[model samples]
Target: MTMSISVNARAWMAAGLVLVMAQASISFAQNSKDPIPPKAPAYFPSVANQYVVRLNHEVPALRTSKAFSGIEDRLGASIKEVLRPDLVLIERRNKETRTSALVSLRKNREVAYADPNYIFQALKAPNDVDYSKLWGMSNVGAMVSTKRGLKGVDISAERAWERTTGSKNVIVAVIDTGIDFTIPDLAPNAWTNEKELGGVAGVDDDGNGYVDDIHGYDFVNNDGDPTDDQGHGSHCAGTIGARGDDGLGVAG
Candidate 1:
C-alpha cells in the first residue's frame, strides 16, 4: 500500500531509528562475545593468618571443651595457643577461610568476640636501643618484664621531633635533685659554664658569686659542682635532653 508521509515525519522516524541503534550498540558492547573481563579482587593488609577468639565467660576449660573442639573442626581451624581460660588463638591457612571462620565464631552464641591478629608497628620511630621502653614518647603497648601501658597514651614526641628536635642554644635547666652531666647521653647536651671552666679552681669566674661552678652549683651542699647527688636529677635531665639518634642509649 502506498502511503504519503510528510518530510518532517520521515526525518523523525530516521532519528528514532538512530536512537534505537545506539541503545542496541551499547547493550551489545556491555555483553560482547569478546567476554566481559572479571573484576580484580580487592587487596587487604597482610595478617599473621591467625585470629584471636574470646569465648564467653561461661565457657570453661576451652582446650578440652567438646563444643569448642567442634567449632574448631567445623571451621577447619586449629588452636595455635591458649592465651587465657576463655581466650584462644586460631590459625587458618587461607585468608578467605580465616575471614569466614572469624565471621562464624562471632555469630556463635558461646563466643564473646573474634578478631584477626593484626600486626602493629611504629611509624618512623628512632633507632634508639630502648625506644620501645619509652612509653611516654611513643607508646606501642609494649610489655617490659610484666608491665604494659595503654597504647597511644603518649606525648607524641616522635611526631614533635618531625618538626624539630630542639636547639642546643635553648637551655633547659633541670632544677631537680641534681644533674649528672657526666653520662655519655647527657654530656653532649649538658649546659656548661664556660667562664667557670676557664677560671681558677678557687676563684669565681665571671664573678657569678660561685667558685669554679664549671657545670652548675650544688645549692644543697653549697658547692660549685652541680653533679647529681640523688640520681633523680640525672633521670630528669636525660628525659629532657639526652643525645638522640646516637644508637648508644634511649633518645631524649
Candidate 2:
C-alpha cells in the first residue's frame, strides 16, 4: 500500500524535538537551587564641611600635670550649659602643644565668624599668617569651600608666567573657588608680596579702592585671597601656571 507523507514532515519532527529539549532544560533548571540575589551596592558616606579651630599655642603643660581633671570638669559643666551636643575637644602636640575645641555652629554663626583676617590674626600675631603657615593657625583647618585639591594653574597663567615667573611683585587674583595654596605644585605661585598689599577684606589699604586685596579678590564673596573652595579655578590656574616639567598631571 502506498503511503502519503507531508512535505514538511522533517521540519515538524525537528521542531517537536527542539520543543522537547527546551522543556526538559527548563524543568531541570527549575529543580535546581534558586540563584542568589545580587548583593546590594555599598553605601558611601557624605562629607560635610565643619569648622576647625587650630590653637596657635602649644598644648598646655597643665594637660599632663594632673590639672586636666579640673579643666575637664569645668569643660563638662560649660558644655552642658552652652556647647553643642556634638562638640569635640582635641589636643595635639608637634613642635608645640596645642588644643582645639570644635563645635558646629549654625549658618548665621558661621557667617559671623568666617572672617579669614580675624582667624589669621588669632593664629598668627604681629605678621599676618602667610598661606604657607595656614596649617599652623588656630581655629583653621580646611575651609568648607577649600576642602578639594588645590586649584591648578591655567595655560594662560602659564604663558603669563613664562613672560614673568611672577614678578615677586605681581599678584594674580583667583576669583573662583578658594585656592589650595598648600599644594606643593602651586605653592610657588601663591602670592607672597604681603608687603606690597594687605589681603582683601572690606578695607582698601593701597588706595586701590578694593579693600584687603592683598593677594587676589574673590568676587564670589567680595573678599581677597581668592583661594578656590571648589577646584575649577585651581584647575584653570594649573593649566595656565602649573610648574611645568614636574612629573604630575598634565602640565600647564
Candidate 3:
C-alpha cells in the first residue's frame, strides 16, 4: 500500500510541474514584443536616356554590325558616342526608361557590363565668414544652432600644428572648377611659374605648349587663365593651403 501511494504522489507532482511550465510560456508570449523591420536603402535615379556599355570583346564594327543593330532595335536604343572599341555610350528611345534599358543591356550575351551614366557633385564644408565656423578642423564640443558638437571629433589641427604648419615646397593642384589665385589668402600660397611670369606676352613659356600659364592652365576654356568661374575649386584650394598665424580669416 505504501509503494502504491508513493508512485501516485510522483505522478501528481510531474503533472503540476508541466502545468506551471505551460502557464509561464503563455505569460512570456503575451509580454514579448514584435521585432522591428530594417529600413530600405535610398534610391537615386540614373541620368535620362544614357547608358555606358562594355562588350566581352572588342566589336570594331559596332556601328555597322547586324547583330548589334538587332539588339539596339529590340531595346529601342542607339549609339550616341564611341568611347572605346569595346565600350560605347548609348541613348535609350523615348519609349524606354533608363532602368529598363540598363536591364536589357545587362541581359545581352555579347555585353560584359552596362550601367547608366550617374552624375557626381563636389563635396565640401560650407564656407563661413568666421574661423570658428570651421568646425571640421577644430571642434570643441560647442553647440551650433540645434546641434551640439562632440569634442575630439575633428582633424586635430591644433596637435598637428605643434609639429609643423605647412611647407611651401609642396604644390597641391586643385583640378575642380578652377582656383581663384587672386584671393588675398590664396594669392600668398599660389604656385607661380617663373618662366611664364617672366616670359613675353602671348608666348608659350618653357615650351609647355600653354601660353602664359603663369599660375595654371584652364583646360575647360583651353586658355592660360585659370580663374575660378565657379567657387568650388577656390574653396578646395583655401581648405588645403590657406595662410596660417597671420591674424587672417581661416587657416587650412
- TM-score against truth, every candidate: 0.50, 0.29, 0.47
RMSD of each: 30.6, 33.5, 31.4
Any runs in candidate 1 off by more than 4 Å, and if so which?
1-123
Model 1 worst lDDT run, 10 consecutive residues: 13-22
Better of 1 and 2 by TM-score: 1
Candidate numbers, best TM-score first, in rank order: 1, 3, 2
Better of 2 and 3 by TM-score: 3
For residues 75-165, could you state the per-residue lDDT of candidate 3 as single tens digits? 4678776676666677787757666666787898877667765543322222334557667777878889999999878876554443344
Clash count list over all predictions:
0, 43, 0
Lowest summed lDDT across 10 adjacent residues in model 2 is found at: 18-27
2 versus 3: better lDDT goes to: 3
Instruction: Name the TM-score of candidate 2.
Output: 0.29
Candidate 1 structure, TM-score to reference: 0.50
Q: List the residue pairs that clash in candidate 3.
A: none
Query: Which pairs, if any, clash in model 1?
Result: none
Leading candidate by TM-score: 1
Q: Roughly what TM-score does model 3 have, to 2 decimal places?
A: 0.47
- Per-residue lDDT, model 1, residue 48, is 56
Off by over 4 Å in 3: 1-129
